[model samples]
Target: MQQSNAYIIIFSVILTVVLGLLLSGTSEVLKPIQKKAEELDTKKQILGAVVPAEQISRMKAEEINQFYESRIASKVVNIAGEEVEEQDGVQVTAENIDVAKNYKKAPEDRLYPVFIFHEEGNEEAANAYIFPVYGSGLWDNIWGYLALQTDMATIEGITFSHAGETPGLGARITSPEVQQRYKEKSIYSESGELVSVVMQKGEGKDYSGEPHKVDGLSGATITAEGVNKMLKNYLEHYQSYMERKKEGTPKMALN
Candidate 1:
């Protein structure tokens, strides 16, 4: 009852083609849904920089999108702090720019996205400015959104995420308790020097009296160092834009 070799080969080819087409069709069908989910997650993270974590967690996906659209405006800026209408002929906006991909490029060549948070009805004045930062963690990539008050020096809130890090240790960067510790922290000194906040060597120490210091993770020294470097690096990257804004320069209209 053995089938001929030619019959077996033909049957295998047909099965392979059929399976490939099914997978391709399924992928095409799911692509948009996957993209929407990714977009929603990004919105949630950006909102987390200013909104309370519990509030964000409680909101539905549609509500999150509505809130983001009404309160957030954004623009892309270059390393020199100039508003860029396009990059390499592609019109890039803050929402669409891939911060992780840009992180792979040289600092001077990367496109920086600034998100401006205003009241629901007031777009003329900003309440806070959120900057996205990316860098290495103990095991993989770590990133966050840092929101500054109107003065553009003090942190209003922050939310961190990582690709791969030890749970209960480095991954604690995403904990709301950890992020809240950065609230009201300053990234500049009294003399106007850009001295970004630092996560000291250990945790449980009091940094309340310190403007530019935060308590580090107890057992994740490497991850703490990663966060410190990310904060300082991105703050410096955005320093020129902040200085211009502080100097009464005209702001660009949101895209």
Candidate 2:
């Protein structure tokens, strides 16, 4: 009886393994379509930042793809903020390819891509800089894209998307009301120092009631502060690049 029971358990375990393998294989088969969908969704989210409300309401996936092909150029950036050397139209990828991986330290050098977007058929339109941002919110990582105009002082658009942040509080990053606060923010001092808009709690937010000073999240103080810190860190590292580009005249070069 003991031997029979052992054989039964072994067979059951083998069956389970086989079933798992079959499911995994199915998932692998579906992964390309899944990845395409995710890429499409990401584009939509980024496009949503600048797309007006009425247009966004009517935006379609096919339209986004067409616009992407015509108007967006993606280049893999190295840790040094240099465009990644490409091979056969594919950007190189390897271990430690992302500078954000070394977010805590002054990265010696790292790689992160920049997305440039422009209007289709606009012969003189300047491309904008769009970078991905990730930082801890009150409850989880708040992730989003920050897009800067050629001047870098004038923000083209920003979209904040968070996971697991409290509803009606930290989650307000996704709110258009909150996002509009980022428009026209100068990340540079007039003397060319790195600085983005600062978020302060309660009574300290509005200094002279300028539009640039956005209010802190009332109940979600931590998340608001997280936005401030993350931008400070990321933009500081990007200062050298911004300054050089500024000197080069971003709008002309973007063309």
Cα RMSD (Å) per model? Answer: 3.4, 4.2
Candidate 1 lDDT, 15-103, residue by residue in tens: 99999999999999999999999999999999999999999999999999999999999989999999988977978889999999999
Each model's lDDT comes to 0.93, 0.70
Name model 1 segments beyond 4 Å from true: 1-19, 249-255
TM-score, cand. 2? 0.79
Q: What local lDDT score does residue 63 receive in model 2, on the 0 to 100 scale? A: 82
Worst 10 residues of 2 by lDDT: 93-102
| Model 2 per-residue lDDT tens digits across residues 1-255 | 657988999989999999999999999999999988877777776676566545755867788788766776666554455656664686564222343354544454545556667778552464687766667888877777788888866677788888789998889888887877777766666676666877768533554345346667788889899888777766765666666567778457656
Candidate 2 residue runs with Cα over 4 Å from true position: 1-4, 7-11, 78-81, 86-90, 93-106, 121-124, 203-208, 250-255
Global lDDT for candidate 1?
A: 0.93
